[model samples]
Target: MRFARHRTDQGPRLAVLDDEDALIDLDTEPDLPALLAHDGRLRSAGEVALRTRRRVTPWAGADLMAPLDPPTVRDFSTFPEHTAGVVKMLDPDAEIPAEFWEIPAFYFSNPYATVGPHDDVEIPPGCALFDFELEVAAVVGAAGRDLGVEDAADHLAGFVVLNDFSARDVQFHEMRMRLGPAKGKDTATALGAVFVTADELADRRSGPSYDLAMEVRVNGELIGQDRLDNMAWSFAALATYASRGTWIRPGDLLGSGTCQGGCLAELWGRHGRDHLPPLRPGDVVTTSVELLGGTRNRVVPGPPRHEILPWRRP
Candidate 1:
């Protein structure tokens, strides 16, 4: 089932997309995770909406919020092509990290700063090379630990389109410190308005991957595209690794890192920095994963560079 959250005069409302593409207001909880905690309650709510046909809102005019505000976000770099592409751009002489092949690596990111479909993302101050990483994120529905791939799949509640926005300049500098992506990534991360249940995507499963077409468009121009099938490490495997030694609770978000050619970082690394310009104020970005949904966001100017100046020793 396709689920969503929309803003209303009252507050954020949980909703389910009907067969007719209308949003049936579940109105039980404010977000997806809360509803997910109720077991089969979400599906039952969908059934009631279809039968009653009352309070059904048209999908066109609804204000979509991020499908889920996960408690935590674990973003994994599982696409070799993206890493390889990045290496080609950053330093052709450098080889892809052997650790990436040896183990699944991920970083914890801010969950509080998530934006929804049609939301406006403010470019972080001092960021001139703004970029977007197109990805698919799995929403954990149940708690588990030390799970196998198949068991991890069972723990997944659903999937959503994710856009990991980045400030390339900040990211590059911070990584040199060998610690964070903190300021570079914490600023903004966008998710699609709709969340598709795992069962809904069962038919699309191939091995441990989904046969989905993922793409991103900037100002109506298609800039990047890739197939989920291309992921070297499956989502299940990543989740399994993340769940090790700790409990993965409901509402945790696990992301498949940037797809091949999914961001300007790799693109500029490949072609030439002069070839593609960074995202700027008023630019629109649309990222989508087939069957999940799409998120369209407009870029807005941030604070003056000086206003957000980072700390430095005197």
Candidate 2:
């Protein structure tokens, strides 16, 4: 089932997609007992129209927030296409470390920002190239450390779609100075339409992207797409990597970065506008990934201030 959190006059409640993909109210009798007790005010009201088998507010009508009330967000570099293509840019003979062939690698993304589907994205003014990255993210259900691949399946709470919006200009500039993926990759991030829980997805296993297919379309033009099964690292590996010497609590999020050929930067990048154009007003970008879900966003020029660190300046 496609589960989402929404707001109504009554309060915030939980919602799920019916067989028809319309929103349904799960607040009545059976469903609410346990989820409500555990989730607290974090939950949203249910969609009653589904009970009556009628359409009241379309999925588009409600405010769709990020998939989970995430406590932490870790993004893994598991996309082979992105890795290989980027490496080839610096050296044709470049190769990933032998250790990489074994498992996943990751980095932290801001956790405080709330994102929703179809939300208008603000492209920071100075960026020469604003790009879209299509990826998958998983929610943690169980809290644990020193977990193995055999134990990974039970820890995941659900799955959601992710659009790791990037500013290539700032990213490359910072990297050349031998810095980490700071300032450059952390300015902004987007979450989901809904997070389909573990019970909903079938054939779950350890894989880079859950065998899903994803595509990125800008202003009605198909720009990028890829298959999820092509990953270089599995989710279990990511979980293990993140859990190393740290406590992983329930509600942590692990993201599988852009899939193979998932973005234009891997295909015909840099010299072409298709790969390197600065986003402008009226640009609509849609990320569609199978199983997990999809999201649509429009680009707008960012605010006057060039940059603001997430925390206040000293």
Query: How many clashes in each structure?
Result: 1, 6
- TM for every model, in the order presented, reads 0.95, 0.81
Model 2 / residue 167 / CA error / Å: 1.3
The sequence of per-residue lDDT tens digits that candidate 1 reaches over residues 1-314 is 89888888988888878887788887476667766776787788877767786677899889888877899999999888899878776686767899998778999999987998888999998999999999999898878889998778878888889999999998888988988888899788999888888888888887658999999999999999999888888888988999998988888899989999899998888788987899999999998888888889999999877654658867
Displacement of the residue 268 alpha carbon in candidate 1, Å: 1.2
Task: List the pairs of residues colliding in candidate 2.
Answer: 12-43, 12-44, 13-44, 13-45, 14-44, 25-47
Quantify all predictions' global Cα lDDT against the true fold.
0.87, 0.67
Provide C-alpha RMSD values for all models, in order: 1.8, 5.0
* Superposed Cα deviation of residue 119, candidate 2 (Å): 0.5
lDDT by residue for model 2 (4-84), tens: 656666565556776656566455322222343354322333334354643334576776656455678888878765777
